[model samples]
Target: MREIREFEERLQVENTSGEIPGFLHLYTGQEAIAVGVCEHLSDIDYIGSTHRGHGHCIAKGCDLNGMMAEIYGKETGLCRGKGGSMHIADLERGMLGANAIVGGASPLAVGAALSARTLGTGGVSVAFTGDGGSNQGLVFEAMNMAVVLQLPVIFVFENNGYGEATGHDYAVGSRDIAGRAAGFGLPAVKVDGTDFFAVHEAMGTAVERARSGQGPSVIEAVAMRWRGHFEGDAMLYRAEGEVAELRANKDPLTLFLQRVEGQVLQEDIEAIDRQVAAAIDEAVERARAANPPSAEQVLTDVYVSY
Candidate 1:
């Protein structure tokens, strides 16, 4: 969780300084959702990510240097400097990729789940979508298809109060994501996304069910995003003190530390924080030193000649 948080904090700084290019969607407050759910997953498991995907990628074990370099458009990036912030993919690590299009991850997870089921891999696929994506027709279709096929997919709707700038209250017709999923004939639950233990417990149940061939499930992680839809967004759509209240009351890191205070040493937590910060600092330096993709390398991955 510290890794994801510190990574994006560094990104916000670097992006502001014009070191990183392209539109960036920082996963500032949604760190626990990814980390908690991914804790139950293994290298053989698969996950589909969102445009705001750095946290998911990190939680799923993508190399920090490759991801930072990818965001910086460096030749050594995960996508060789082409896919940028919204499209980093490390297939070898079972991250299908992060998609820019809303609802894109739903069917991607569906496909992966289908393959897993067909090949008897005992792996599960997860789709991480935002509240806005929960409203997409493709997402519903993907969910329905997953139910119909009994595939091992988990639909995690990280409802962070808005679909971009629009409040979810104004957009989501049902106003209840888990209830809607339950209506679709799958076991669905809503958990406090800020509470890592809650999310981890819910995901553990869902993962167990999936691996046991009990089919797909839905997990609605009710949380906050702490930043704009994208880095430059002013977020005028929110009421005054909205983000401030979330930061003060619902901070995932703080909540997690509080929960683990007696069981884990504060000094150990501080050490992890320092380690994550230094690691991100090194990633930034490596990205800065790395060259952009050469012109000769540009068209290589863009096409399939065969």
Candidate 2:
């Protein structure tokens, strides 16, 4: 979680300084959702992410240096800097890229789940979407199809309150996103996304069900994003001090530390923090030093010659 936070903080700083190229959608306060759910997944289990997906990539074991380089638009990045922040994918790690379009990964996750079922791989696919994405018609279609085919898929709704600036209350028609899953005959549950244990437990159940060929499940993780929709957004739409209040008292990392206070040593935790900070520092330095993709490579990955 600390690593994820540091990654975004660095990106925000670099972006503000005009070092990072292109638009950046940061994943600042939604660490637990990725880490908690990913803890139950292996390399074989698939996960699709959103525009704000740095946390998901890291949680799924993507190389830190490569990701930082990718964000920096360097050739050493995961996609040779072509995919940038919103489209980092490592299929070997089971992360099927983070899409810029809202709810775009729903169908991708469904397809992966279907493949797993057909191949009898016993692997599950997870679609990580936002509150705004939950309203997309494509997501509903994918959910219905997963249920009908009994595919191993988990639709994880990261309800961070706003869809680019509109509040969920104004945009979402459903009272609670998970409630709508009943219409599709899937088990749906809402959990405290800030609490890692709660998310882990809920994901565990869903994973078990999916692996056993019980079809899909919907999980509404109620959390909030600490930053605006994008880095440069002024965020005038939000109520004054809302994000500040959450950062002060409701931080997921802080809550997680408090919950695990007695179980782990303070020094050990501090050591981990130092290690993560150092790693992030090294990644940033490497990304800064790395070069961008050459002109020759521009049209290389765009189309197949054959």
Candidate 3:
């Protein structure tokens, strides 16, 4: 949890300083979901991330230096300064990139799982979408398709209560997101997204089901966002002190710290903090020194052999 907090703080600094161009979607309060899910995954497994994907990327073993550089839009970035904040990807790490469109990655993850099954690769695909995206038609289609194909995949719905500025209660007609998945003949479960052990346990069950050819399972992780939808949102819709209260009382990092305090020493947490800080600082220096992509390079990768 200290590691998660360290990354969140680094991301906050970058967002506030305008180091990460375009939009900055924060995952400040949803760390446990990513950490717990990724803990059960291997390097060969694929994960499709959402707009708020820094936590997922970090948990999947993506290099912090490259992630920071990518967000800064530097040539040394994972996407060579072309993808910027919304589309940072590292295929070698099995991160299918962060999707900008709502529910866009759902079908993509299903397709990846289908390919894995077809090729007998024994690899599973995981899609991490938000509460807002759960309403999209694509999510339903992907769910049905995964059941039909019996693909090894896990659908993780991080219900953070708000989709952009709109509340989930207003946007989604259903009271339970995971309940909707049962209609597609898939097993589903819900977990408190702030509890790492709960998420980890739920994901273990879901993954085991998928690997055994039982098809996909939906995991609804109910969580909250500590920050607004984006960096500059005035958040007029949210009530006063909502975010503050969540940060102070229900923050996943804080909860994890409290839970592990007796087992893990304070010095260990401090060491992680220092290491993350140094890593972020070095990434900023490297990104600043890196060159942007050339004008001609944009048109060069459009075709395979044209």
Candidate 4:
């Protein structure tokens, strides 16, 4: 969580300082959801992410330097600086990339699950979508197909109250996103996203079910985003001081610390913090020194010869 926080803080600084070229959807407050689900996944498993995907990429073990460079549009990035912050992908790491379009990667994860089922790879795929995205027709279609095929997939809904600037209450017609999964004949569960252990335990069961060929399941993680939908967004849709209050009281990192305070030593936690901070600092330095992709390379990755 500290690593994700530091990475996003650097991006915030760079975006405001004009160091980064494009827009970014930061994964600021919803760190536990990604970490918890990904703890049970391997490189063989696939995960399709949303616009707010930095945390997912980090949790899946993508190189921090490469990801930072990708956000900076440097040639040394994961996608040769082509995909940018919203489209970063690394197939070798089973990260199917973060989609800029709302609920765009749902089918991709479903496709991956289908492929895994057909090939007998024993791999599971996860689709990470937002509350607003859960309303998208494509997500429902994907869920329906996963159920019919009994595909190895997990539909993870990170219900962070608002979709973009609109509140979920205003946008979604359903009372609970996970409840809709039952309509598709899939097991559904909801976990408190603020608590890492809760999310981890829930995801463990979901992942095992998918791997065991019990078909896809849905998990709605109730959390909140610390930032707006995108950088520079004024977030006028949210109530004044609501974000501040959540940050102070409902922060996942803080909650995690409180939960494990007696079980873990303070010095051990501090040592891990120091290590993550230094590593993130080094990644930032490397990204800063990296060169941007040349103009000639723009057409290189855009086409393929038959």
Candidate 1 per-residue lDDT over residues 100-152, each given as its tens digit = 99989999999999999999899999999999999889999999999999999
Better of 1 and 4 by lDDT: 1
For candidate 3, give the lDDT of residue 137: 97
List candidate 3 stretches off by more than 4 Å.
1-4, 303-306
TM-scores, all candidates, are 0.98, 0.98, 0.95, 0.97
Pairs that clash in candidate 1 = none
Model 3, 67-167: lDDT tens digits are 87788877778887777777878888889999998988899999999988888878889999999999999999999999998889999999998999999
Q: Deviation in angstroms for 267 in model 4?
A: 1.3
Cα miss at 60, model 4 (Å)? 0.5
For candidate 4, the per-residue lDDT at 30 reads 89
Q: Which ten residues in a row have the lowest lDDT in candidate 2?
A: 297-306
Q: Is candidate 1 or candidate 3 better by TM-score?
A: 1
Residue-wise lDDT of candidate 4 within 42-153, one digit each (tens)? 9999999998899999999899999998998899999999899999999999999999988988899999999998998999999999999999999999999999999999
lDDT of 3 at 12: 76
C-alpha lDDT score of every prediction, in listed order: 0.93, 0.92, 0.85, 0.91
- Please list all clashing residue pairs in model 2, or write none if there are none: none
The numbered model that scores best in lDDT is 1
Candidate 3 Cα RMSD after full superposition onto the native fold (Å): 1.7
The true-versus-predicted C-alpha distance at residue 1 of model 4, in Å, is 1.5
